[model samples]
Target: MTPTHPKASLLTRLARLVRMGSHIAHGFFILAVRYPHLANAERAVITRAWARKMLSIFGVEVRISGDNPGFYPPNTLLVANHVSWLDIIALSSGTVSRFVAKKEISDWPIVGTMAKNGGTLFIDRSNRRDASRINGQLADALSQGGCMSVFPEGTTSDGFGLLPFKASLFESALLAKSRVQPVAIRYLDAHGQQTGTLSYVGDHSFGLILKRLLSMKKLVVELHYGQSLQAGEGELASRFAISNAARREILAGLNLSDDTPDTARQTLACPQAVTQ
Candidate 1:
C-alpha cells in the first residue's frame, strides 16, 4: 500500500491489524471449539469455509481455472508446487482434500493445532522411517477414497518454477492404483504480474510475515488444475516417471520454463510471507 503520508501509512497498518485480529479470534474459536465436534466431511467443509475467510482477512483474492475437482477420480493424489503457507489455505478453500505437510508444522503456533484439526498428514522428513510409514498410511487413505494433496517439491520457493519432486509419494499412489492430479499455485500482484511479496522463504520470522501480509494492499492468487494421471493396464510407469510428469504439468500451468534453475525461478529479493 502506497500511503501518501507517514500518518496514513501508520493508520493503514493499524486498520489492517484490527481486521486481522478480528478474523484471528473468529478462526480460533472455530478451531478450538467448533472443529472438534464436526464429522470428517463436515470438517472439510468448515476448513474450506475458514480458508476463504482467512484469505479475505488478509486482503487476498483467488482465481481458479482449468480442470474441476468434480472431474477428479474418487481415489486421487494431488501434487503441486510449494510456495508459501498460503498455498495450503488457497488449495483447501478449493478442494476438500487433506494435505501432506512437514511434521515440524505440528509444532508451530496456533496454525499447527489448526492444521491438525484440519486433518493434515504430517510427515517427519528427518526420520527415514517416517517416509515408509507415511507411504503406507497414504495408501490406506487412498484406498478409502480420500483426497490427499502433497507438495512433491519437499520445500517452498519464491513463487515461480517448481523444485524437483521427491518420487516416494508417487509410490503410494501407485500402490493404491490412485489417480494423480497436478495443481499449480501462483501469486500475482495487482497488475497480474508474478510477485514475491506473498512468498514465505528464508529465515524471516512468522511475525515478519504477518506484518508484511497485513500491510499489503491486496494479494492475488491463481490456481490451475491439470488432467489426472493414472496407470494404464499393461502400461507400467515407474514412480520417477510419474513424479516427473506431475511436475511437468504443474510447471506448464505456472508458465515456468521446464527444468529451470531455482535461482532462475525466484529472481526476487527474499521477502518471506507465511510459512516454511
Candidate 2:
C-alpha cells in the first residue's frame, strides 16, 4: 500500500523544498572545516540532524528496540544488516556514527557526495590489497576511539531475510579490541506489508525509488540493537560467532521463525563466551 494523501502536488513541492534545504545544510559543512576543533563533533551533529530531516521529509518513522547505549570509549563498531539506501538515513538520524560502505557507493552521484561529506569509509571489495589497506585504516580509526558502522552482510537484501555475513571485515574489531554491537533494520509499507523497498537489490534504480519516496506518505523503520560482543582468542572464530548471533537477533526481532531452511541461517561455533 502506498501513501493516500490527496495533496500529491503539495507533498511533491514540499519534498523538493526540503531537498533544497538539505543541500544548503550540506554546504555548511564546508564552512565547518575552517574550525578544526569543532569539526568532528559538529559534523556528527549536523549529519544526524540532516538524517532526521530527510526521514521526516520522506514520511518515514523510526522505532527502536533494545538499549540505545551511548557511544562508550567512543570506539564501538556497529554491525548491522543492509536493507535499502534508506537504512543509512534511518540509522544516521538515530545515532551519530560513521559508516563503512563499498567503494562503488563512493562514485554514486549525490549519494557519493553525501557519503564523503558524512565521513563514510569506502572499501574496494574486488581487490584484496585494497581491502587489506582499508582494514588497516579501520583499525587505526577504532584505535583512536572513532566509532564506525558496518554491514557484515556484504550486500543489501529485502527486509525479510539476511545474507551471509562476510567475516573479513570483523577483523578490525579484533585489531582494536573494540566492542561489536549487532543491529537490525526492518522496513515496512503503509498497509503493513513488508515491502522491502529499503533493499536496493535486483535492477531497482535509485532515481526511481527517490521519485516513489517523494510520493509516499508514510514509511516505518525498525531498529533493533543486540548484545555487544568482544573479540576473542581467534579472529576467524570470533567474527563467525558474532555474525551468527547478530543474524539470530535480527531474525527474532522480525518475528520470523528461526527454523528457515536456508544456508544463511546455519549457526557457527562461538569462539569465546558471550557476556549477554
Candidate 3:
C-alpha cells in the first residue's frame, strides 16, 4: 500500500518539466548577459530566485531553523554536509554564493554551463595539486568579500550521518580571515522523517535522480545553521581545528552521536537539536 502522501501526477510532472526548461533558459540568459552588469545585491536576488524556482518545480520545500542570518555576510565560507547534488540548489535558494564542486560537474550538459557562469569552482580530485589551486582561488574569492561554500566531506553521502570533513578547504577560510558557517542539511518526507529519496549517491545519473525527485510525493529540505565560527588566533584558528569544530557543530545540529553507526549508504536523519 502507498503512504499517505500522494505522488505527483503525470500531468503535474509534465507541467513542472516544461516550466523548468523555461526557467533554465531564463537562468542562462541572466548569467550569460545580465549577470556581468548586475550589482552584487541584484545578482544575489537573481540567484535566490532562480534556485527557489528550481526547487519549486521539483516540488521541494525548504524548512530553516536557528537564527536565520538572512543574507550571507561578505567574506563568509559556508561548510555543510553533502547529501546530494540537490544540496547545492537548496543552499543557493537561501543566498547568492559560489561553490567548490567536483570538476566533472563542469562537463555535465546544460547544468555545467550554468554552474560555470554562476561562479562554481570545479576541482579535479585525481590531482593533488588541484586542491591547492582551489584553496588559493577560494581564498581570493573570500578576500574579495564573495561568500563561498564547500562540501568539506569531499563527496556525497546519505544524510543518516556525515563523513569526516576534509581539512584542505578550511585553510581558505583561515587565509581569508572569514567566518565559517556550519550548516546541517536534511531531506525529509511529509511526516518529517529523514528520506533518501533525494540522495545522489553511488552510480546514480543526473537524469535518473531528477526523475526520481520529480515523482516524489513530498520533499522538505531542512537547513540547520549553526553559530558562525570566528577566525580566532592561535590553536583554534588552525585549519584542522576549524574543520573539526565545524564538524562538531554540524553533528550537534544533526543530533548525531560521534560514534553513530555508519548507515551512510542506507538511510537519512534529521535531529531536532538546535545549535544557533
What is the lDDT for 183 in model 3? Answer: 90
Q: Please list the residue runs of candidate 2 whose C-alpha ends up more than 4 Å from where it truly belongs after superposition.
A: 1-39, 71-73, 108-110, 233-237, 261-276
- For the record, the alpha-carbon RMSD of candidate 2 to the native fold, in angstroms, is 6.6
Q: What do the candidate models score in CA lDDT, each in turn?
A: 0.72, 0.65, 0.78
User: Which number leads on lDDT?
Assistant: 3
User: Which portions of model 3 show Cα errors greater than 4 Å?
Assistant: 1-5, 263-276
lDDT of 1 by residue, 21-74 (tens): 787778778878987787667767777887788788777898888786752246
Worst 10 residues of 1 by lDDT: 267-276
| List of clashing residue pairs for candidate 2 | 83-199, 84-198
Compared with the true structure, the alpha-carbon lDDT of candidate 1 equals 0.72
Worst 10 residues of 3 by lDDT: 267-276
lDDT per residue for candidate 3 within 170-268, as digits (tens), equals: 888888998888899998887888886666666655576678777776889999989888765565578889988889889988899789865445222
TM-score of each: 0.84, 0.81, 0.90
Candidate 1: misplaced stretches above 4 Å? Answer: 1-12, 71-73, 231-236, 263-276
